[model samples]
Target chain A: MDYVEELKKDFRYIEGLNACINCGVCTAICPAAEVSEYDPRQIVDTVQHADNDEIEMLLKGDTIWYCGECLSCKTRCPRGNTPCYIIQSLRSLSIETGLFIESIQGRKQLALKRTIGEHMLKYGYCVYIDEIDTEMFPEQGPVWEWLRDNREQILTRLGASYRQEKSGALRKIPEESMKALQSIFDVTGATERFKKIEELSEKKAREMKISFNSGKDDYFRHLYEGHND
Target chain B: MRYSRNEVWETYQKEIADNNFYFARSCIRQNVLPAAEDLFLKIIGTDLGKNIYDDARQTTCTGIAYHSGIIPFETTMTVVAHLFALMNEAGYENYACSCVTSFGIYSEVLETWKHFPEKEKEAREALKKATGKTFEIPKNLVHASDLIYKFRKEIANRSKYRLTDTTSGLPLKVVDHIGCHYAKIFPEKGIGGAEFPYVLAGLIDEWGGQQVDYPERRHCCGFGFRQYLLKSNRGYSVANSKKKFESMKPYKPDLIIANCPGCSFFLDRWQYVIAEMENTTYGENGYGIPVLTYEELAGLLLGYDPWDIGLQTHQVAVEPILDKLGINYNPDMKYKGAGNSNTDSPEQPSSIKMF
Candidate 1:
């Protein structure tokens, strides 16, 4: 199937794209559009008029990745379309086709898959406290390092359970619940998606001559760092 | 203006349950600002005498993964359905979400299920297959800020310190950044609608602060999930926040409040980054504007200690605001460890002042 047909196969694309009147309301309100050259209207227009090649180019490019998925586009689209949803469908298709590795932004799927995705299956939280460290996330500031060093004590003072096997803030999610969540992921194709990301990323890492080791390895770090400018 | 303010606000009013909440925590908030959730239960349950239960069995709604495109909609829907089953088991009808993204995810899933019964059946079957659990959707799904907004007046009456500046005797100029997910996805789901959500504004106003309307009042804080999660794309994340901070700078707002955990985290942390990168600060005296969650604001007004509420966790110090409100605290205790132990103070940033 062509990229466009694959996108339309998803319900989000169907609901998010009716007919683009090119009203520019979505772009006008989009935060991503303001900061970067990411025009949601142009994206919709491109998809609407594109042949299979154009669709393929978009899937491999950074345009779809630029959307913050804020869904501000849904609030004002005259045709009741959601450009954010369209971008989502495109992103999913991009990852599924392994075309995401073609762009700088799209390649970060490995970083997300390893961190938020893997963290969900392991820790039951997207942003696990233990995963965060000052060396990796210096932007968390000095206070965060201090908080990290004294987390248990500080959190205990503030009344959070904080890895305790009790029912309260930041309490450790039970083993049974984690098993069920993993089962849901496996059954719902997320496990497959994670595997696909790793497989594609591994292939791309070899092509670039970067090491593909476990955890936050050389390839993962390469995709994660640089290009902030 | 094209729309009437009173009419728009009245039209956008949502029905929030008064009490008995099944609290769903945010991963970011719990990890970063643990005191916000801690004080939320204290204020809602102990202070206001309401029934809000927090079950340890509840897991993430997988909104972050769903947004990042790591997980498909089916997975998120199944996860949310599982959460609803937990709520049902706890015998709670009203769902209060600590995270705006989770609130948006829940809103999206519920709306989708309503539009497509087949998807709902799919989610039902998926949940049953995975966990052997049947679910009942909550009667009322609300962001935790909506509940706080609902009882703003009650909270105001109990506030130890109004948002008025103790020294100036004037309402402190406050900027409230409502998370885009809270209303942008489904405007009808949020209070006061998308263009002008009153969730935080109501809190600021009722507690004696003036809400500032800046050019970027409706702009996103730019968490952007993967955009910020990956270091390389952090420029995009921080740049969006920089836009909002630049626009709000001229307003010289004394405080910035956000309902979303991601928004609050980025807005707070990005100030330090911006200050370091650009060598400029927004708040007075080279300190960045004190960014807060609505829960943290309530904690302050209800006279919770700064350290106890985890204000010390903030990158940009809350001491300036604490002083402005005349809330007394031991400055020496700012970095105190759990057992009255004095810890090493963090090295302050050269650009943005830190406590």
Candidate 2:
């Protein structure tokens, strides 16, 4: 849990971390600190004083995850310390330690699955599952009606063809590259996540009132708001 | 039309990315036939086909998964190495992405790879093991836009079009939206001048259009991934768009231009979506502004047919501007604009007094 060494080593960009004057300006301007408890000034103060234990605690804490990596602190850090980047570096360290794994893991998978579902089946950008009501996106609305009327035109313009490309036309993947990707999928559990996303996405698509027979056509039409059902 | 010092430095960084380039294929382009690449080559003078090595074992950066966070750090590292490997194979140290997210991922992965030697080694080993290749970050990496801006004079010189108003002979006014990823990720390296920036605005000016101002020019299109994901407030994106629209509305310029597709998508589509949400009329008499890509706008000034340039694909119509200019356009031009006409008088005389 001694992050001082890691912090010092990882953030070589900040040559003099111990030089922070602790004016609290970094925390004041931090977007994450404003919305969440993650204060960069506090992190800098702890690191500057060599408070290794508190540094570790802060790194593992939820405060680290809330930093949006905006680097507003870096720009205004009168002491030239990049607490924003430091917080980000620490957050990655936390992820490596398996902290916040559960919360972070499946959400991306779910979102991707949803996106692929919308892209593949519905042919539109994936809608927020919570915003599924037709009333919220009234079918007769000008945008909706324009899409409905010009569905084919929109699809054609977007260059979507529901049909999969003929396999051999794509650049052939080197066998080694394929093998490496396969191993990466196994190591990161990305294959399973992709599968889960694909499954959930398909289910959501089925639940929808619309269906497109051509994946390419469907995607383009959906992109342009051509199909309602 | 003038670039600040920071903007100039950002252009230098982008030039670094462009000089040592690694082109990534986009899904949209995969379906549409490499229009992005074609446009890039036309605008920037690099033929990706000629520049990229045939033996280069390039792979998808899997940015889609990275943004979704479905891909773990280890996997992301491997993809990063794959990019470096491509660059290394081509004998180039710098890597650049046509897509904004690709640039962001390159920046993110490069930062992470610097710390974790093991991960970097693993990624290098993965590439070597996979393709009998080794990789390393060159001196720098950058986005294509950065590079394009670097060669502004060259692009302007090569340009085939000249601006002349059919009626008044005034140049067109434009507003620019620098992608959030470009500006936010490497603030020092992204476009400069205005804090928000018109890196592409200078490019427009090079091609004969005058760059104009818009409100909320610095704000992200609310497509900040998290904003869209958390669905915290649809208005967050809309407000950003509204600020931009209101700013440009006064200028009553010909078009709103963007370099990044995501920004274009949001700025182009969200006006109607936001207008519906807020129940307010936008544009002239409730019409929304036309959002264009730097390429499309350049193509327009360069005299490329709007239809051929894919202008018709945009949600907000640009035809009205063409009609206003009295340029003869095909009425059947597949693209249509939102329902509104030019009820306002002819453009006001320039209140702009350049310092």
Candidate 3:
């Protein structure tokens, strides 16, 4: 994929890129700089000079993954530059080039793909990991007991019914929408990736003596706890 | 006199002679049961206590997840009908929510049901066949915020603690981040200056706190479905945070405030996480800004111990600011009933029910 052209399509970021005066102020104030050698100022400098090769290298580097995307630079930049957005654009570009495949974030990437696919398949909603059941782990004791105690109160508060008035009715997804979502998932290789993660996560969970539940809810629950082991 | 769901519910239980009441909940709160139930009990306590029979047939608004594309439209509709059935079961035509999202979902679903009576009928039948009960959205559903703001004066009168800042001799500047579901779902009904809602800000001022005006005050935290998922870029989250932080950075307020848990989580934690990721300084004069939930902040100003309310667990620490204000905070002192009902006070009720 011609990632540069893909990014060029969204020129809003270019406006931000154009505003950079190469001031090291962003770097001086950057938390990532303190924690790691990744420099926002350098990334801005490279992009400003149109050093595509250097930009590509920076994108592929582990340092880019270190960005918390806090936007402090964008908030404080005198030139109104948003290095954070630029870094994201760079990440998308790097992903296209398969450079991201080598990073830890790349491993996490499969989790996203899987989550999107599962949401499309089951809930028609993106399943967040926080919704999963982490009862068995007992990191803080049985999560289910904790949830059980407040379940009624929670449902009443949110006004959600515990059981579907009609359970099976929710299973049916429109053929066309399902296809469209599936195609998107396929294009992104999300389905395959998700399956792999699920298998691997379950395996890891079993090895670690952590209970792993199947289905979208469990997937998201584990994901939320960063327990995709 | 705007009262939070708890304040309203408590008042209802104490004063209202009605037992049949309407109820609603937000999708996000479905996962975080305690917060949701705390608000629910408060609303119930204020409106109709034990006399109010909770209809078991209630369904989810499923708005946030649906809006986020995590849940399908068909599922959302089914959930909507389920809520309607609960209302039918309870035999009440009125409902309320502690969350802006639930309120918006209820309103939207109610309107949709009106527009598509056939579809509504189909859903009703489907639900009836499955649960042996019928459901429908009430003609009058309200966000708890609206109800609370409606009775702002009463709340003020009821307030027990008188807040005074001896050192600054100035009111605390509070920046309000009203939930997006509230502003976007029912613009007109929302209290706190719906369009440019400063109602919460005003309420803060009424509580002896200064409401600070900041740019990007109305922007969504990009926790909106697509934003949180599209982690590769985090473009929306970053942009939204930047706008708010930049707008407020100049004011150098003591704290940034939020109503919703998700928004609070992002605004409060994102700064530290992002700063760590981007290597940037978020604090004023190289110090980080503390983000507090409206409840937490209110509890503080009301003379409630901050530690009791889980203030210590907050990622963006409020210690420096509290210390600067010469207020004593016992990090080890847990709120009397941090996770139990016994902790609920008449002034600051926090119990919530899920079903």
Question: lDDT per residue, candidate 3, B66-172, as tens digits?
Answer: 44322323445555665565566557776666456566566555555665566566656655554455555565655544444444454556554433345767666
- Rank order by TM-score, top first? 1, 2, 3
The TM-scores that each candidate's chain B achieves against the reference are 0.97, 0.75, 0.74
Q: What local lDDT does model 3 show for residue B296?
A: 53
Best of the two (2, 3) by TM-score: 2
Candidate 3: deviation at residue B137, Å?
2.6
Output the better candidate (2/3) by DockQ: 2
Give the number of the best model, judged by TM-score: 1
Quote the lDDT for B156 in model 2.
62
lDDT of 2 at A46: 74
Q: Worst ten-residue run, lDDT, model 3 chain B? A: B346-355
Residue runs of model 3 more than 4 Å from their true location after superposition: A1-229, B1-21, B27-60, B160-164, B192-194, B233-235, B279-287, B301-303, B320-328, B334-355
Candidate 1's C-alpha runs over 4 A off are A227-229, B1-7
CA error at residue A75 for candidate 2, angstroms: 4.3
